[model samples]
Target: MNLLFSNDKRGDYPQSWYAASADLLAPFAPLGGVQRADVCVVGGGYTGLSAALHLAEAGLDVVLLEAHRVGFGASGRNGGQLGSGQRLDQLKLEKMLGAEDARRMWEFGEEAKALVRGLVERHGIDCHLRDGVGWAGSSAGSVAELHDYAAHMDARYGYGLEVLDREAFAALCRSPDFQGGVLDMGAAHLHPLRLALGLAEACVRAGVRIYERSHVHHIQHGSKVVVQTDAGRVEADHLILGCNGYLGGLDRKVAARVMPINNFIVATEPLGDRAAEVLTRDVALCDDRFVVNYWKLSDDKRLLFGGGESYGYRFPSDIRAVVRKPLAQIYPHLADVKLEYAWGGTLAITMKRLPHLARVAPNVLSASGYSGHGVGNAVQAGKLMAEAVRGQASGFDAFAALPTPAFPGGAGLRTPLLALAMSWFALRDKLGL
Candidate 1:
């Protein structure tokens, strides 16, 4: 399958509600000729921009190249849930990599949230940041599990969480589908595209050079790395690859470590009084299932519903049709609501459901495979990459040390195998497994 990035230009912005709502305020020229910098970062999304900001602040001459406009990929199209921690549960992480490492990982997630908050305030980014996120249970069994999970977090990690009964949760969400859930104050939701744009602006203000529409086609690595774009080239002491699922053949090793999965979302027409009756609070709500339904009310009172995943490279012909069922399953009243816009974005996934961070070569680093949890982890990965390049490799090494196995059957057969495996999980979700 041709990579998503290899396809023809899909236009600057998708018809998602976020793009329609948020104000994009920055514009940068594309790379025109050969340039030299202390660090050359590829992909102008959150990861690349964050790395550029940190490196430039450290006095490194940083140059960032994006294939399209900044935040044109998943960074602009995500559900905007600033979720806490890695994709795996804390206990699961502890079991996988000892308690000491798990605690440090948890701390890193905390720092990620704090970093986002600090950048928003320090850079004066108007991304509509808010607190509190609810994890709605899809079934009674999941409700019990959430309650247990909440209790464990409070007991072991001392993380404050409110466990809501079915009645309380239904009152909060105004949905009968969920039995109960947990409300975590630490997690949050925000305007993702705005945040991405803000980071790009911040990078520029920090004296980092940004080149838009400069797709990196090749790289020559040695003591110093040289990145070649379609129209220009960049020579730098270090190179950072931040393109997630849209990453093409720029680096085959990092590309093979992740499987690109396409996900879609839909935004409903403004509900006015009807929206108020649907959600008691403005907090984002995500269900507990393999293929979870995550929704939140936009500041404009539109319902931004996100769900549905595809292992194939091509997006579904009718994205709304593929997402409507899941949206209705959560909010049956919304079955009649008019969907204003629908769009899809691709994300990278790993077999162990963990992010893949590693060094492809000396002075060359790459991080992807955030799965469905890129909002926070991606930013953290960029910060860690900066630290590694600055010679403080302890934290970065911890994550880079995590084992990332290659996809089975190589790239040729990986997508089909992933589709087959994901189908079993989707079936389990339907059976309430």
Candidate 2:
């Protein structure tokens, strides 16, 4: 069961709404024979593409390899929410790494979001970049904590988020289940696949060589790294592993700390004027749950709802109905609506929920485990990795200092144990605990 080929075909993007809407580029030829570059990036998602773009812009020869098309994985099929701050809450980070370091991390998160915005504007990527993200709460206790956290962010980090009470949130979200929430104007949403495609085009314009269907099977490490694919090989001064959830068995250390999980999403038929019922504004809504329910209206007035999680590698048979169970909970009016498209994607997660950035070797670096906060973090990780290769390592150091532990049960049993733990949490979410 190779993740790259198990559920999908070679060179084919997932049948997602993002794929249908995005202006995809002609497929890049796969790597053949042998090649050499200053940097060889494995994986063509946001992280690898950004690294290739930055390194190329810095006048370094860069080569990027993807098993499938660019943005073929979670990069194209996610909820598309550009969240504020790191995957872990700021207060939790403050306790884990202390206030000074936590403040630095917060600034890094701000930099992450700003990097995405700057790239989109600078490259003229028309990904429907919209502002505002509503962090809704379902229970009264959760609502109070949301308010407290918003105030804490304002006082300590000067975040300045808008706190919405139950009534106010209902007026905007039109959800009966939401008790309250906080609206972060700093956060935003977009067409994820379009953004990825734009970044890929930018990489090409910057002189980076991109090869699709070039699956990297092994990496020979030494003074210089040689990344071996099925049909070709790439020897480079630096190697970057940006494969995220799809990185199976390539590196033991990363595979130990970062566990892959499957998530599903569904896009409803165009709602026309009814789009305003779910979202009065164009903002996205994501609830605070172990298995979160995230949704937003597409430009064509379709509701793109993402939910449901599977611990194993295989996606469920019916992804749309799995997501619909939760989608209807948030928008009951859409219970009987038609689903236009449904798809599933895999992403990496760490024990602490923070991204895992490590040197891996003297000249090799890897970053993954953004834990559903990949949109901003993955781009920043790539920039920082590129900076480290250029001899400035402060940004990478900040992330490398974060603690990421391996799963307790190791490779064989970790998935089952994680399934049990996630099931418990999901039960608690349903019980409103």
Alpha-carbon local distance difference test for all models: 0.86, 0.93
Query: Per-residue lDDT tens digits of candidate 1, residues 76-111?
Result: 889888888788888889999898888888888888
Off by over 4 Å in 2: none
Model 1: residues >4 Å from true position, as ranges? 1-11
Worst 10 residues of 2 by lDDT: 1-10
Q: Tell me the tens digit of each residue's lDDT in model 2 across 1-433.
A: 7777777768999888999999999999999999999999999999999999999999999999999999998888889989888999999999999999999889988989999999999999999999999899999999999999999998988889899999999899987889999999999999999999999999999999999999999999998899999999999999999999999999999899999998999999999998888889999989999998899999999999999999876789999889989988888877879998999999889999999999999999999999999999999999999999999999999899899989998999999999999999999998888
Per TM-score, the best of the predicted structures is: 2
TM-score of each: 0.97, 0.99
Question: How good is model 2 by TM-score?
Answer: 0.99
Q: Which structure among the candidates has the greatest lDDT?
A: 2
Candidate 2, residue 25: Cα displacement in angstroms equals: 0.6
Record all residue pairs in model 2 with backbone atoms less than 3 Å apart, i.e. clashing: none
Candidate 1 residue pairs in clash (backbone atoms < 3 Å): none
